[model samples]
Target: MSRATPPSLPFPPHIHAWPDRSTLLADRELALTELHRHSLGVHRVLLLWLLALAAIIGWSLLVLPVQQFEERDPTGFLLGPVFALLGLASLSPSVIAVVLAVRRDHQIRQLLDAWLALDSAPVSDVRLRSPGLSLFWLLSSLAVAATGLWTSFGTAAGAQAGRSTYADVALDMGIGTILWLTGLIGVVKAVRHYRWALRTLGPVSTAGRR
Candidate 1:
């Protein structure tokens, strides 16, 4: 039987050229390592759908009817479970994203450590920073944080002024907190990465590679 070669990885670029063939092997290996996490980029979205299904199934099969199955009171059986379901539906996305972000950060740090130990020279050639994406993330996060601040405090102000109901204010605050924390975390993570890259990557600190 004839031997077969694996197809090349999907590399994103308009023009393709590798000028220096000397470090190509190391560079390819680095790309493959990065690709491992990038592969999760879209697949992780399935988690949202999975969570939604879980919520629905849990509500239908367990929550709705199982509450004092013999009890005849509708309020006890329905109202409490409905509110809990609503809470889960509202909060699960943020919880899931936070978990994923933490996991990804760990994976990235592990990769960097492995590369540092191996003295991977290819790290120098590629620009590890994505300026455009980074800019978008920073700006978008700030916008979200700003909106959240308004929603959080502005709603309270309205409620105190008798312009809004307590229940309405509580809902708004819940939403605002999620947005505020998410945006703040994004901003902090970006800053942390910048500082870390500065200290670890170029000339500030010594890595085995560069």
Candidate 2:
């Protein structure tokens, strides 16, 4: 009798292959390394951005003589609101980074445990994308845009009242516009990076393995 060929596996055979423990471990390491690399880059950029924003807010407060002006002055009246906007923008990113960091740590621990387990089953799919971060970015972008709109309205009102100079209004509007644009760009980039990561680490099927 002729020997028979083995049955054909499912589509995307490479991904669905039931690899040996060593191969599984190697794949896990590769995935973890890529994740860590991207995570570090994202965290570094966000932290630096937050620090720079804080510095700008501090410098603006120190240099502007808003305190000397009476509360009746439009510039003085707008000072608190403008500072609050900047502070909130800074806080959103900080909170996102912190939450991500904690989740990342937990993920690392789970990955390690999965790799060390004696069972031959494929690892469960991990959630690389964070909904919390996505939500924060979405809300932050809206907040930034809203703040810009408010600044524009205030600038127009001040101009009409002859209390604020054109240069001052232009500067505030420019800053607000920049913040809104940058925040939007960051959200897009971060989301794309996460999606790329998920695709790169192809999900393994646990149908056949124990």
Candidate 3:
């Protein structure tokens, strides 16, 4: 199908400069770089929630078992549920991150659509990704997924041992499931974005540089 050419229109209020095609692409490449950085930050934040999970689990391990074994102290019993509550509540951020990540992925697709729609778009010299960034995504995602897999089994074991309540198992297993899905999706997205970046943002040819 023949591509529809845009109508000649005056620059909107947001515009001040009329850049050539190459220049516009370069600017867009920079925008994509920033988006990539934002994505990394979001992923990091998502991972940080696990620390809260770990702390809650740690609190439970330290306080609950001792109370049960030693004296059935009501304080420990009370505090245990508090940590569980916090653990469950802390999932809010992970959920937010997931929402943001999903939205950002949509934004990325939209951005790519617009970027490609530009008149005679070509590769840009502006670098969008640093070396090892993709590797970081792959490794970190795999690690998180593995952690999720491990924790899910651990939660099940604890439940079998009667160490955890239904709520505890549910929350713990919920966290694991979220982590597992997020990590796997992250890895896939990293691979995808990396490929797109390479195809559309490679260093410009010498002839094209002129």
Whole-model Cα lDDT of every candidate shown, in order: 0.52, 0.48, 0.56
Tens-digit lDDT track for model 1 on 1-210? 111211233233212334454454455555544633342222323343344344334333333333334344567556766656665664565467667756766565555544444334435523444444445556766776788789889877767644544445555676676567766765665566566556556543344455
Give me the overall lDDT of model 1: 0.52
lDDT of candidate 2 over 1-210, digit per residue (tens): 111211111223243344665665565545544444344344544653574365446434432444325334566556756765665665555446545754654464344344324233334323333445545655565665566567656666667545665445555654565455545555554565455434543332422242
Tens-digit per-residue lDDT, 53-117, candidate 3: 55445434434444443555667666766655664455555566566656766675555445444
Candidate 3 clashing pairs, residues 3+ apart or interchain = none
Error of 2 at 96 (Å): 22
Q: Is candidate 2 or candidate 3 better by lDDT?
A: 3
Residue 18, candidate 3: C-alpha displacement in angstroms = 2.0
Candidates arranged by lDDT, highest first: 3, 1, 2
Using TM-score as the measure, which candidate wins? 1
Between candidates 1 and 3, the lDDT winner: 3
